[model samples]
Target: MPRFFKQPFFAWFSPSPSRLQRRQLRQAIAHIIGDQPSNLDVYQLAVRHTSAAKETKIKGFRESNERLEYLGDAVLGMVIAEYLFKKYPFKDEGFLTEIRSRIVNRESLNGISRKIGLDHLIEYDGQRGRLMPARTSMYGDALEALVGAVYLDKGFNFTRRFILKNLLSHYDLDSIISNNTNFKSRLIEWAQREGKELRFEIISENGSSQYREFIAQLLVNDEPFATGSGYSKKKAEQSAAEKAFEKLELQ
Candidate 1:
């Protein structure tokens, strides 16, 4: 548990941060999200990773960013879908969906998080590293959680603007569309051509009942090659394949 949860007096409640610390965090978040928030708790919760999380005594829920991540995923996807629909007026649904997927994927969001310095602000158990494994989407998950906080704090219009101006502005849609490659399909082709035994299997599933997590591991020559996770098997497979694609250097 983090020191913030350790109050000499009321151990059940989180202690208030120092005035200077509060100001610094508020400024940092304002720089990222483009607004000074009225409610700091929501944004603070956005960056708290599960490894450092504390469960509520009554609710039986940890004070982590998972719920916010879920909400933000939907909000971010919808905004991206709407933007693509308008920008590519004559594009087919397939094209729109593919482009949107490329933009909103975990790796893509993680890269953006690094670019925008959001990775620096996330609070997790760094020593034990309980939340980080290879190719973990912690950075992007924090970003999604931040988006959820923005939505809750400032409402949809502000959140949409923040997504467009702060997030999407960092992307080049035309370049992304042209350079897009589906790792799972490419990996499948590589295996077929090289006569290498390749497969993907779901190793685990755990999350809220509304959105179950699927962890998929890629196997090559009957050995585990790489693993990835998502809300669905197909996405988990895709994520695992992406990691495998990088390691295998498949074209």
Candidate 2:
């Protein structure tokens, strides 16, 4: 069992964790992550979704997992890159990058987070009165936040061990490497081989500046082939290219 407020910095927060909440949270963290968390508040914050974030006095903006997610994104990428480097000492940069992308992509992380039961631990605002489906990225985002929490609580080496020994160990690396998809590259290659001109043009943009959505259309031989939408121009192009690839079924 991990002791709460064990650090001097945590003591400054003036936390008062109920016995039951502390026990339950500690046990849950231990079970899910296979380690004790030094800072309970950080873990709690990590599991808190933006929808459920509350306004804080320090700043007008509410506290959410977004910052932690950003930190974890960088941390996760670095650790995974290191792991892949060591795992395949002779592999080329492109190969390593492809494998890392396959491992860290939104779809893969969402699936992995669900597999590790992070979905059940997330705290979100379900009472917002929306009948639509839940976003798949939420689980993945929480997973990243959790990684941030782990990093904060236990430092880099511990987080690395947790990721490598606990999380990455569960994945089938060989299969991931084999099934790596670079749809944009594939589309470009297909266009070159078929002697067709390929162009990806942004059709529209929406959402706030911080979180923008882009719609891209794939034009083959100056004719529209397929359209796709994503959070960025590159993502949209890749998505459009994926659709085009599927439609063309290039061998």
State, as a TM-score between 0 and 1, how close model 2 is to the true structure: 0.69
Residues 109-172, candidate 2, lDDT per residue (tens digit)?
7777777766666666656535121344787898899899999999999999989987788789
lDDT tens per residue, model 1, 26-47: 8978888877888988888888
- Regions of model 2 farther than 4 Å from truth: 1-18, 129-134, 180-216, 219-239, 243-251
Model 2 residue 20 distance off true place after TM-score fit, in angstroms: 2.2
**Most accurate candidate by lDDT:** 1
Superposed by TM-score, candidate 1 places the C-alpha of residue 26 at a distance from the truth, in angstroms, of 0.2
TM-score of every prediction relative to native: 0.71, 0.69
Which is the leading candidate under TM-score? 1
Regions more than 4 Å wrong, model 1: 1-16, 131-134, 180-219, 222-251
